[model samples]
Every structure is written in structure tokens, then in C-alpha cells.
Target chain A: MIFAEQLTKSYRTKTEEVKALLSVDLNIPKGEMFGVIGPDGAGKTSLFRILTTLLLADSGTAVINGLDVVKDYAKIRQQIGYMPGRFSLYQDLTVEENLQFFATIFNTTIEENYSLIKDIYEQIAPFKDRRAGQLSGGMKQKLALSCALIHRPEVLFLDEPTTGVDAVSRKEFWQMLQKLKSDGLTILVSTPYMDEAEQCDRIALIQEGKILMNNTPENVKASFSDPLFAIRSNKMYQLLHDLRDDHLVQAAHIFGEDIHISSEVINQQVIIDALQAKGHTQIQLKQINPSIEDVFIKLLMHTESHEQHS
Target chain B: MNNIANNQREVVISATNLTKQFGDFIATNAISFEVYKGEIFGFLGANGAGKTTAMKMLCGLSTPSRGSATVAGFDVSTESEKIKKNIGYMSQKFSLYEDLTVTENIRFYAGIYGLSIPVIKEKTAALLQQLNMESQKNVLVKALPLGWKQKLAFSIAIIHDPAVVFLDEPTGGVDPITRREFWEMIYSAANRGTTAFVTTHYMDEAEYCNRISIMVDGKIEALGTPSDLKKEFNSATMDDVFLKLARNAKRIGD
Candidate 1:
């Protein structure tokens, strides 16, 4: 439903011209939940703005639902629900008023699209008269999302929707998106959480305005080229230092209970031998599959070093 | 770890029947816990689980409505100033001054902590070199990348060499590599006998802590090491443990 070819955007700072998006391309089919996973300042907001027709790119063309972004900006704005990363709602207005306001602007009434936002709106119904600013973080989020869906747009673009949310609420928010997707709505969301990336049908790992890898989550994890292993012992803290100190080990990071290490030639015996020599007892080592987080870290390191050299 | 020697180690922070009541609403309901010296303690809860209320009491930012607590041997109820002096605080929201140069920020913080001019100068140089940001020492903090800014904020948080440090989501929204690097920095500081009290949403980070307390509905639902919590909840990872405890929470802290 959304397609962009060679999309580019840049911003002029006092001392530099920062490229926010560079030759970026994306193709999201209808009814697919596409995720743009990246850290803060990774140009997620820029890409979202371009797709939602809120901002124009420096060059290149973008099409949404078969309409060119620049030419059909008005229609795109009417048909897409965009939730900004920063909460942007009428703070002084009550929760009910905000939803009514959004619906009114889109030339629809809340009752006209009641079924679309019913599941989400019902949670905050008791607080209908509460001011948007007075609601707690989670309540405000639910209200904002309810307003976004009040218009029942064909496509939904949420930028960093789960950035600062707690764990349980984060899960709930994703489930809501899944329901919307099942209703045949094309969804585009961005977040810094790696685990949330798996919830998407496919994800584009964006960093520094470039999509480093674009594919299914499984494919992204499977694309990890390094030999990965998980190691843990009694001296967990010292073990990290010992593993990182090894010249052969490329990266050693803590992943849950064990330390995941990547290297060129990773032998379970060699790692155990090295840790044992460092007085790390109860050493457990296992050849492990790379998670999406591991793949992203590896890709990030590659790009970072490449930039340094250039 | 403190879990194994629970009764023997020095308790850096002790909250005994601590409660905070706002009219009829109980933000914190008689929560009790102990953080041992040199241990990395993970404080976690849902949005309105009273985690912040409990943390504010521990940090001496808010007076408790009932019970008592002591941070670094200073009574939080009466010796709040002393407690603040003995502990360092850093939150991702209100971090280093963006308008200030890196050197100026570090020097200003150290000076506030009562460090002499010579000590501040020496520590500033060493910190810049260790972070490999000597070239950017004079640059505005806002000009630096997010990763560098986070790392610098963390280093400066512990500049006073306080007895314990409080970190509130220090690694939020940063890249994975930088997040790991931040953890390594935490591990290094803890190794030097400086205790760390951290609050984070990342379950993998919860695993790195020496002990964790999962709060639910104005009370601590579970408190133990990562492995013990997993076993008690019959879960595999810390994420599962957190979900099992926090899923039932109904209250949201403001």
C-alpha cells in the first residue's frame, strides 16, 4: 500500500548538512504490518513524515495507495492515521473531546467509526471527561491511539509508539495493532524495542537514514554471518571483561542469563578453555541462534566502522 | 551476589514498612526491601505500580507517609540532605545540560559535589581520554551523538564517587552496541564497590542485575536474583518473570 523509491531528505544545521534519509526505499503490501526498527535519531520520524505526506523529501518520489505523495498530499492526509512519537493532542481537551475533534476534522463522527476504535476506546471510556493532559502515561497513550483510529484510515503510521512504555502495556499495544491489521488496515510502526520487531510481518532495520536489512524477521536473524555462542559462569562480570579482552572475539555482550559472543572461528571448547583459565567456574557454553537484536548490533557495528574509515 | 549472603552484607538501602498516602490513594503500601552494598539492584514495575513512589522515598526526594528507610546509613525521613549528598542520581529525562560544553558540564557537576579544582581538572582529562572523546571535549553536549551523550552522563553521575548511584532508564532509545557499552560501564563502577540502583524496561538488562524487585499495585510482588525469580515464576527469561508478576497490576502511578 506504500511505496517509496530513492527517497532522500536532509536538514541544515549551523555547522553541517545532516542527511536524514538517503536513497531509502520501502514497499509495504496491503494488510501487512511493516516495522521500522531503529534507535533514536535514526530518521524514523523523517521517513514516517514522508510516507504520511506531512513533509516533503529532498528528492525522489513516494507513492501511497497508488497516489503520488507530493501530488495527492491532501488525500493521503485524509486516508492515513499518523501518531507522532511525541504525544501531539489537545492537552486541555477531555479524552472524549479529543476523539470527537479528530473525527470531526476527518469529516466523520465517532459513532460512524465506533467499531474501529471500540476495543481501544472502551478502556479509557470511564475517563472520557478527564483532560488529556491529566491522564497518566498509559491512559494518555490509549486515548491518543483511540483518536488515531476514530477516523478509520486505510493506513496507520505510528512513530515510536512504544518507546517509553512499560513491558506489559507495550505487549497490549502490539496486540491492538494486530487487531487493526486483521481488520485489513495496512500498518507502519517504528520502535526501538527489538523484541517488538518480531511482532511485525516484516521489518526494515534503519540506521542513520539507511535501511541496512529489509526482510522477514526470521530472514534477518538467519542472515547473521558470524559464529555465535552463549557463555556464562560464576564470575559473570569478570567473564565479560575476559571475553571482550580476547583478540579473537569480535563481540561479547550480555543476553539474559548468558553472555553471547560472536567471532570468526567460535569453538565451544576454545571459549570454555579461555574462560576456565580466567578462573571462571561453572562455565556453560552453547552454540546459539542469533536473535534480531544480535543481527542489528552486528549490522550497526559494520556500518559504524565503515563510516569511520571513510 | 547479595542473594547468597543476604543477612551478612551491608545493606546500603533499607526500606521498612514504607508507605505513602495521597488522601485516600496509597501510592506505596508498606513496601520493604534492602539493597546491599556493591550489588546491582534492578527496580522494575508497570506504569503505575508505585515504583516511582517507592524510588522517590528511597532517594529522599519525597517524605514517606509511614514507616522509615535509611540510605547509606542516613535516615531518609530526617537526613534527606545527608542522603542526597551520599547518593548520586541520573535520569534520562533530565540529563546533562545541552547548552554546556562537555568539559564545562563535567566541571560544573564535580564542583557541585564539592570536588577541588585540581581534582576536577585531573578527573575531567582522564574521563575524556577514557571515553575517547578528547577531540569533542570542548563541543556542546547537544552536538554529540546520543550514545556519547549517554556515556558521558553516566560517567559524570559517578564523578562524586557516591556510596550508591540511581540510574533511571539510562540506556533507553540508544543503539544496542551503546547499550551494552553502558552496561559494561555499570559493571566497572560496581566492581569498584559503588552500588548501583537501576530501573529499566529491558528484561535482558534485568538479567544483568545482581538482584531485582518487581513491583505490582503499590507493593513489591517478587524480589530475588534473576535466576531465582525465573525459577519461582516457572519462567525461562526475565521477561517472562516480569510479565508473570506485572500482568496482574491494575493501578497506574502518576
Candidate 2:
């Protein structure tokens, strides 16, 4: 279990002050997978660092497993495993050596907590003699995770664990996380990818050091207020331009091959007629449900415009 | 609307039996493909699947051990200098001078391309206005957000107005909205007759490409329009198609 109240942090440089975290309030239940979703420099790293007791927050408080992050830093460290965004394992050492090092640091051995990371370690066990630096991206990640879980920590903090990885590796990494979650470990993960947001039990969409929305992916998507449509044509660039010019369309942005548009009225005939008038042929328009990316984009746009107006 | 129209487009890049070997390792094993003008071509593969090696050969950054290829109207092996001149390159790493201001970076790159002072000034102003970053023109590149830096790097890459551009995972680690906006820029460039050769692991991004080639174990396993590939594989999504192709790879993370 983790709890935080009015957490704030700021970095003051010679030129300007950067507000890394602004009143970040979070409550992650025991054994729940909680995701902190945001772009880079959006305070996800700062929040994770504060909660892991690696960095002190400027104000407010946080507790992990009923242990204060500041007052009980040592105990909290023992209960939680923190994987920074960058790989922090000893690259020069062999995979087995790295695991042994981490296990020794926690005053334990690999045999004691073998079950916690057995699934992950088995994947990299064949290359136990290989240097950690020589392993592939996916293999390195698995090794790092094995090292982290060597002491059987109650909670896992993974920051952008899948970033810059190939699609298959990313998928595999998520699968591993799901297995870990099934074993009753509370997981707190941060990533900028919206597709990964759906994997978590619940996610908080953070931006500019603030939380925009926090809920289940389904609930967040269901909260989309406008009628959404997916439109595709032979001339996609032209179609995007024409759709944006239409007064009835409130938002028109490309989602993959098709343009996802939000409109005030759900009139497919009118939209088709307008595109036809614009000499766009082979048009396909269908009302569709919203995804987490759609909701996040809408929320982000609203926040930007609100800031500009204010 | 139909995939047939793509066949009639002018070919900007063509390769036959492109292969690269590192001693006992065959990094790229006789891969062949063609990219047409004014189209977004997606080159996709798993990590260590030889995508980067293939891209380097195409970009003239690395030489093929045994193969023949033509890029931007020049032979890749012998006329790489000419090929480099007529193509733009952007990678996942922001390739701008972080210590320099926006205008300064623009001027610096323009100078490298031998642009005159007036032309550099004119283009710099237009780029800033087009990106709507006039307010941050004097700010240091490090001060900008990751999304803005990516967009700026992309714009600067194509500022030379090359015939084609190669982007290696250009939208990695950015949010969906920023990725969407970056694609809008790519679409605009393609509209102006600039061919795009991009490699990305994002399956959703693969859908946006006019055509895609999926590589596995140093060989291209599938190549077609997204819909055609989906139909051929009997899959509904690019992710599924990729998994189906990559599952047969003999080597992973090599």
C-alpha cells in the first residue's frame, strides 16, 4: 500500500525555477497495478523518486506500507524495489554476479527469494556467464528485474521499463509484469506510451507536474463527452485538411491510417456530403468508440487552451 | 483508396539483394525493397533484427558487404556522398546542439548545407513561424520539452529540402498527442513530394505508413500495404501481423 498527500518539488536553476511535482496526491491500494502516465519531463520520474525515498520532496508526505518515505527510508528501501529509467545494473559484472551483489546488499541470498523472480530469471539464466552489458535490450531488462526482485520486495517501482524497446520485447516485458502482479506484488509503473496505460488496473494521466485524471481505462474512455468518428479516404492529407475546416467538427486528428474526429452532431450523411463536395472520393466514415489515447488528447488540448486563455 | 495507385508512383529508392555481413554474422541477408516518391514507407523489425543495419546501408552511413542499391538517384556504394546530400536524416536522439538557441541551431545547420546568409535567415523565420515557436526562438534547445525538441529536430532535418528523408524511430518515448502532431508534419512533407523512409517499433505508427516491410532475422518476412498485410496474415492489427512474422525469427536480440 502507498499513500501521498500534497507532494510538491521544485528545481531552481540560475535562470528559472522548474516545478517538477505540484501537489501530487496518490493512493495505490495493496496488490494493485498503478500507472503514472505522462510525457518526458512531466514529473513522473520526480514523483517516483520522491516516493522511493531517493529524493526528498520540497513539501508534503508519503508512506509506503505504513512506513514514512523520509523517516523510515531504510525500512522502505527494504520493502520496495526501484528501477530507475536508466539501467543501473553493473554492466561489467556477469548476470549472476549482479544478482548476487543485489542479494547481498539486502542481507539475503538468491536462494531465499528464488520464487519471486524465477519466471524472469529463467529467461536469462542461459547467459548467466555473459556480462550484463552484452545482453540484449530485452535480456538486460529481464536481468535488471531479476536483480531487483532478488530480495523479494513487497512493491516494485518500474520507470519506463519498456521505453525504446522493440514491439515484441515491450509486449514480453508487460507479460512479465502481469505475472509479477498475479503473485500479489503491488506495482507502480510510469510510461509515456498510452497503449501501455491500458495494461494497468488504474492510471493517473499526469502532465506539467499535475494529475489530469485518474480512473480505470474503461471509465476514462467512457467519459469522452463528444461523439467520435473514424474517417479514411484515398487522399488522407487532403481529407484531414477538409475535415478540420468543417464547422461541425470540433476536433480532427489522425489516429493511425484514419482521422479520428469529434463532432457536435452525429450526422454521417452531412459529413459525407461535405467531403463529396470537396471532391474527396472513396470516403469511409463510421461512428466509433473512444480509446484512452483519445481521452488523453482531449484532456491535454483542453488544458493547453485553458492555460493560454488564462 | 486503392493500393494499385502506389505501383504507378515514381521509385525513389531501390535495392536488390542488399546484404551485410560481420564476419560470421549476416546482419542483413539479401533484403530487397523499393520505396516510391512522396509516400511514407515503414521499415519495421524487432530489436537486433537488422533494421538498423539495413537503414544504415540505405542511408549511406554503412556499406553493404555484397549488394547493389540506389538511393535518391545515386548508387549507395560509390555515390554515397551524393546520396547523403539529397536526403535528410533524423534519429530518436535529438540531433540538435542543446547548448545553442533555436535560431542558432538553424543557422548552424543551414551553414553546413552551404546556404547563404539571407536564405538561412528567411528559412529560419519561416520554420519558427510554421512551428509556432517564435516565442521560444531564443531559448536554449535543452530548455524545450521532449515533444518540442523532436518536432524541431524533424523540421531542421528537412529544412535543406532534400528529395527524401530517413527517420529512425523519430517518435520514440513521446506521448500519443505529440506523436500524432509529428505525423501531421510528416504527411505535410510527403504532400510536397518528399519521400519518407521510416523505421519504428510502434505498431500504430506502422498503420499510418502507406506501405510497410516487416523484417525478421535479417530477412524481410512481409511487405505490403497495411490492409493487404492484415488480410494476408488474417489479422486485424499491425501488432498481430508483426508478432506472426517475428515469431519465426531464428535470432532475437542479436
Candidate 3:
């Protein structure tokens, strides 16, 4: 279990201050897969660092498994596994050596917690003699995760674990996480990719050091308040420009080959006529559901407008 | 922005049996494809599927062990110098100098391509204005947002008006809005007769390409327009098509 109240942190440089976390509040239940989604510099990493007791928050408080992150840093470190965005494993050391080193740090042996990491560690066991640095992106991640779980931590903190890996590797890594979650480990992951948010049981969408929305992916998408349509034509590039210029369109963005538009005026005929008038042919417009990315973009736009108004 | 229909476009890149081998390993196994001018071509594959090796050969960064190819109308093997002059490349790693100002980066890239000082100044001014970041021109590259830096890097990559541009995972880790805006820039460039050769892990991005090639195990498993590929594979999305092809990969996650 993880709980935080009004967490805040700021980094002050010579010229100005950067607010990394602004009153970020989080409550992740035991055995829940919680995701924190945001863009770069949106404070996802800062929150992870604060909660993992690696960095001190300037204000507020956080507790992991009823242990204060600041006061019980040593105990918390023993109970939670933290995987930073960057791979932190010893590259020159063999895979088996890295696991042994981590196990020793926690005053435990790999045999004691072998069951907890068997599914993952077994995949890379054949290459136990190979140095970690020579492993592929996916293998390196698997190795890092194996070390993270060498002590059988109760909670796992993974920061952008699938960021640079290939698609298949990313899929495999998520499958591994699902297996870990099924085994009753509380997982807190952060990523910028919107699609990955769907994999979480619940996600908190953070932006500009603030939480915009927190709910199930279905609930968040169900909250979209406009009539959305996916419009495509022979001339997609021109259609995008035309849609943006149209007064009836409220928000228009390129989603794949089609333009996803949220409009107040929902008459399909009106749009078809307008495009016809613009010499567009083979035009296809149909009402469609809003994806999580669409919902997030709309929420972001709403937040910007509210900021501008206030 | 114009569509720039692909039917009448000229071939910007042509390859036949392009191959690269490392001792016992065949990184690129006789891959062949064609790219049209003023079109966005997506090159996709799983890790260790030979996508990078094929891209390097196309960009003139790595030589092929066998077969032959032409990029920007120059032989990839013999006229690598000429090919390099006619193409621009931007990778996922931010290529701009972090310590240099935004304007300085533009100037440095333009100078490398042997552009006149006057042209560099004009292009830099136009780029800054186009990005609407004229005020940040004097700021160090490290100070800008990730999205802004990516856009600037892309603009600088094509600053010399190359015949084609190659982007490797250009939108990785960027926010949705920024990614959308980046694609808008790509579309605009394609509209201006700059062919785009891109590789992305994002399937949604693959859908935006005029045509796509899915490579698996050092060979192209599928190649066609997005719609045609989906139809041929009997899949509803590019992601599914990719999975169907990549599922047969011999070296998954290598």
C-alpha cells in the first residue's frame, strides 16, 4: 500500500525554480496496478523518487506499507523495489553476479526468494555467465527487474520500464508485470505512452506537475463530453487544415490517417457539404468513440483554457 | 497543405537484394524496397529484425555486404558521399548540441551541409519564426521542452532542402499533442516534395505513413499501403498486422 498527502518538491537553480511536484496526492491500494501517466518534466519521476525515499520532498508526507518514507527509509527500502528510468544494474558484471550483489545487499540469498523472480530470472538464466552490458534492451530490463525483486519486495516501483524497448519487448515486459501483479505485488509504474495507461487498473494523468484526472481508463474515456468523429479523405493533410479552419470544429487533431474532431455542431451532412465545397473527394466521416489519448488531449486543452481564463 | 498524390511521384530510393553480414550473422538479408518522392514511408520491425541495419545502409552510415541500392538517385555503395548530401537524418537521440543556443545549432548544421552564411541566416530566421520560438532562439538547447527540441531538430535536419529525410523514432516519449504537431510538420514537408523515410515503434504512427514495410528476421515480411497491408493480413489495425508478422520472428527480444 502507498499513501501520500499534499506532496510537493521544487528544484531551485540560479535563475528560477522548477516545481517538480505540486500537491500531488496518491492512494494506491494493496495489490493494485497503479499508473502515473504524463509527459516529460511532468514530475512523474520526482514523485517516484520521493516515494522511494531516494529524494526528500520539500513538503507533505508519504508512507509505504504504513512506514514513513523519510523516518523509516531503511525499512521502506527493504520492503519496496525501485527501478529508475535509467538502467542502474552493474553492466560489467555477469547477470548472476548482479543478482547475487542485490541479494547480498538485502541480507538475503537468491535461493530464499527464488520463487518470487523465477518466471523472469529463468528467462535469462541460460545467459547467467554473460555480462549484463552485452544483453539486449529487453534482456537488460529483465535482468534489472530480477535484481529489483531479488529480496521479494512487497511493492515495485518501475519508471518508464518500457520506454526505449521495441514493441514486442514492451509487450513482453508488460506481460511480466501482469504476472507479478497477479502474484499479489503492488505495482506503481510511470510512462509517457498513453496506450500503456490502459494496462493499469487505475491511472492518474499528471501534467505540469499536477494531477488532471484519476480513474479507471474506461471511466476517464466515458467522461469525454463532446461529439467525436473520425474524418478521413483522399487528401488527409488538406483535410486536417480544412477542419482546423472550420468554425464548427472545436478540437481537431490527426489520429493516424484520419482527423479526430470534437465539435459542438454534430451534423455529418454539414461537414460533408463543406468538404465537398473545398473540392475534397472520397470523404468519409463517421461518429466514433474517443480513445484514451483523445480524452487526455481534451483534458489537457480544458486545463489550458481554464488556466488562461483564471 | 496538399495531398501530393503518390501515383505520379518519382522514385527517390531504390534497393535490390541489399544485404549486410557480420561473420556468421546476416543482419540484413537481401532486403529490397522503393520509396517515392513526396511520400511518407514507414519502415517497421521488432528488435533485431534488421530494421536498423537496413536503415543504416539506406542512410549511407553503413555499407552493405552484398547487393546494391540507390538513395536520392546516387548509388549507396559507391556514391555514399553524394547520397549523404541529398538526405537528412534525425534519430530518437536528440542530435542537437545541448550546450549551444538554438540558433547556433541551426547554424552549425547548415554550415556542415556547406550552405552559404546568408542562406543559413535566412533559414534559421524562418525556422525560429515557423516554430514561434523566436524568443527562445538565444536559449540553450537544454532549456527547451522535449517537444520543442524534437521539432527544432527535425527542422534543422531538413534545413538544407535535401531530397529526402530519414527519421528513426522521432516521436518516442513525446506527449500526444506534441506528437500530433510533429506529424503535421512531417505532412507539410511531404507536401513540399521532401520524401520521408521513417521508422517508429508506435503503430498509430505507422498508420499515418503512405505505405509501410514490416521487416522480420532480416527480411521484409510485408510491404504495401497501410490499408492494403491490413486487408492482406486480415487485420483491423496496423498493430495487429505487425504482431501477426512479428509473431513468427526467429529472434524475439534477441
Candidate 4:
């Protein structure tokens, strides 16, 4: 359970000012998997830093589980576990050593919370003797996560937890997160990966220091307000280039070997005829469902249009 | 012409029954693959997949317990020094000095690669301008944001213009926008005839590679264009393909 009222953060340099987060209001429900999705420099990290009490917001208020982030910083820090985007554990320490050290810092022992982190801890248990620096990217990831959950904080904040891990590790990590969620922990995760956004109970699409949209994954996807289709042909490259030039096509971009087009008209026959006239054959067109990434792109386009109109 | 054929024929690195062992445990089994000139190859797997071990052998950072590998036209076991000079490597956790200024870090890397001062300065300016970080040239690396640091680390890795560059999760922790931008930088390097060997956790990012190899249980289970791999696995998406392969791997072990 987290609530923020007009949260804002700005970093002032000697010559210029960088607004890391603009006036933003967000509410994360208790025991929910809430995702903060954005690209680089989109204030995802800044928001996490603020909520974790490592960085202070210039204005507004934020409270986690009835404790104010600014006023009750110490208590908030003790109640939530945070794994930063980067590997911030002691590199010189071994995997077990780092876990032990973090547990000690929280006035707990690994044995005390072994049940909480046993799934992740077992993966790295074989290499517990290896230095953190010597472990692979994915191993370090598991070690970091185990350390974060060692204290079994009520609230968990994972910043890009799967960023540098391999696909298997990434998938495994998400499954672990889901298990943790079932345990009734209020989890907040920030990620740049769009696919990961779908796994969350709800997500906040952030960009340029602003919250663009906040809703459940299905609801956010259903909000896409345009007719979409996937088109492919023997001449996919040329077809994509030509499709973008068509006046009827609102937005056209190459997605893999096919061209995903959003248009004003929903009729599939008209599009097929248009491509046939362009000398394209073996053409397959289907009204396809939009992914979260597609919706986000559309939202971005809509924002651009609204800005232009204003 | 002849140049194109010669280029295609040239294998910058090749592995033949390569294996790595730590005592009785085999980190890498007898595996074989070839990397072509100027190709962006994705070396991928779950944790403990032996991707890093394979990379180390190719980079001449570690010796193989058995089998052989030729890196940058040199035998990995015999001519490791030559391979080191001809290749550039950026680890998952980049090795840039936090205390050093952006310019200073570039210079330090250039110096390690035996680059001349004038050449380093010219390249540094061009690189900074390309990355739009010229204004932050004097800023300490510790003061820079994560994205900028990733970009700068990549730039420094190729400062010497090594024929091959190995990037281990170069865009890790970066937001999607920055990841796309970083890939553009990587594309530019590839376009310049620099072969890129990369590894990543994000399945979407793997779609950008020219070719990808999915390793499982110390062996390559699938290798092809991302689309080809997806099709071969009868999966609609790369993530689905990865899951199928991982599940297959587990079933085999069981």
C-alpha cells in the first residue's frame, strides 16, 4: 500500500536543472504487483530512489504502509526491501558473505528468513563460496534478490531485476516474483522490458518524467483505440516502406518480418486490395490483437497528436 | 565481387569440440560453432548455461580443458596474446573507473590498446559528439547516469577499433528507450564492419541480433536468425521459443 500526492523530483546542476520526475500522483494497492514501465531517463529509477528513501523528492508527499517516506524514513527503510537496477552489493564479498552481511544489517539472520528466499538462495548455494564479482550475471542477480528478501520486508521494490539476466533466468525470476506476490507482499517493480509489463497486476507507463497511463495490463491494452492489422509478403521490406507512404495508414512500422499497421479503416478487404495493386503477392493480412508495447506506442502517438493540436 | 566472397569465407572465430572443466565438473561440453566476419551474433542462455565460459575461451581469457578454438585468426590456446590485442571485451558489469572523467576513461582505454594520443583525442571527440555527450566530457563517470555510463563504456570498448567486440549484457538495467538507442550505437559499429558478439537477458533485445545461439546444459540447442529459431521451435514469439527450449532442457535432465 503506497500513496503519492503530486510527487516531484528535480536535480539542480551548476548550469542547468534536470527534472527527474514531474508532479505525479500514484497509488499502489496493498499486496499487488505494481509495475513502473519506462525507457531510459524516464524517471523510473528516480521514482524508486525516492520511494526507497535514498533520494528526496523536491515536493509532494509519499507514504508507504501508513509511514511517510520523508518523515518516517528510517522505519520505511526497515519495512521494505530494495534491489537497485545496478548490482550494488559488496563485490569483494562472497555470495554467502553478502547475504549474511545484508541480513546482519537488518538485524536478522539468513536462517531466520531462509523460507522466504530459499527458492532463489538454492540456485546460488553452490556458488555461495564464490566472490560476488566472480559470479555470472544471472548468479549475481539471484544473490542480490536473495539478499533483498533476506529480511522479508512487507514491501519489495525491484528495479529492473531481470535486465541483465538470460531469458531462462529472467523467466525464472518472474515466476519467483509471482510466488512472492502470492505470499501477500506488496511488490513494486520497474522495468524497461514491455513483455514484463504484462506479468504485473497493474502498471504505470512513465516517460519524460510523467505518468502517461496507469491501469491493469489488459485494461491498458484494451484502451488502444484504433484498428490494427499485421501484414506480411514476399516483399516485406518494400511493403513496409510502401505501407508507411499510404495516406490511409495512420501508423506503420516493421515488427519482425511483418508490417504492423494501425489505420483509420477496419476493413481488411480494402487493405488487401491496396497491397495487391502495389504488386505484392503471397500477402497475408490479419486483424491482430495489440500488445502492451503497441498500446504504449499508440498512446505516445496520441500524446504527440494532442500536443500538436494544442 | 571477390571481396564479398572472401569476407563471407573468413571465419573470425571457430570452435571445435571445445570443452571447459573445473576439476571433474564440465562447465562447457564438447561444443562447436563459427562466427563470421562482421556479423552481430547473440550468445544466449539461462544462468549456468556456459555462455560465459564459451566466451572466455573465444576471448582467450581462459584455457579450454579439451578441444580447440581459433579467435581472430589465432589459435586460442597458443596465440591468446594476439587474440587479446585484436578483440575488445565489455563485461556485464562494465569496468570503467567511476572516479575518472569521461575523457579520461576513454584515454585510459585507448592507452591500454596502445593508441596514439592524437588518434585517441580525435576518436574521443567524434564518439562524444555521436553520443551527444560532448558537454559531459569533463564530468566524472560516477556523476553520469546509468545510460550514459553504458554508452561511454561501449565507446571505450571500441576506442581502439578492435575487429571484434564482445558485449556481455551491455544494456542491462537500461530503460527501453535507452536500450533502443544503445542498440543503434551497436548497429552503427556493426555497419562499420565491426563484428559484435553480445549476450542479453531481455528476449526482445535478442530479436535485434543478426543471428542467435541458445545454449542449454553446456551445449547449443538452437542456432539461427531469431525468426528462424522462433519458427523452428513452433513458437510465435522469442519468449515462447526460449520457454520451449528451456522446458526441453529440463525434460532431458529429468
* Candidate 4 local lDDT, residue B126: 94
Q: Which 10-residue span in candidate 1 chain A carries the lowest summed lDDT? A: A301-310
* lDDT (10s digit) by residue, model 1, range B1-254: 32223356888999999999999999899999998888899998887888788889888899999999999999999999998878888888888999999999999999998899999999999999888889999999999988889889999999989899999988889878778878778878887878899987767667778899988888888998888898899997788889888877777535
Error of 1 at B222 (Å): 0.2
For B103-195, candidate 4 gives per-residue lDDT tens digits of 999999999999898998899999888778878899989888777788888888888888899998777556444554576667667767678
CAPRI-wise, candidate 3 is medium
Runs in model 4 deviating more than 4 A are A13-15, A52-55, A72-154, A226-288, A297-310, B1-10, B95-162, B247-254
- Show model 1 residue runs off by greater than 4 Å: A305-310, B1-8
Q: Model 1, range A192-244, lDDT digits (tens) per residue?
A: 98988999999999988999999999999999988898877887788887887
Mind sharing the TM-score for model 2?
0.97
Off by over 4 Å in 2: A305-310, B1-7
- Model 2, retained fraction of real contacts? 0.57
The interface root-mean-square deviations, each candidate in sequence, come to: 3.2, 2.9, 3.2, 7.4
User: Candidate 2 on B54-144: residue-level lDDT in tens?
Assistant: 9889888899999889998899999998888889888877589999999999999888877899999999999998888999999999998
Report the lDDT tens digits of candidate 4 across residue range A1-310. Answer: 8889888988888867888899988898899999999877779899998998888899999999999998899999889999999899999999999999999999999998999999889888988898999887777888888988998899999998877666766788899999999999999999888889999999999877899999999999998778888877755545655676775488775554456788767677877788889997888888888888787766666565324311
Candidate 1, clashing residue pairs? Answer: B48-B252, B48-B253
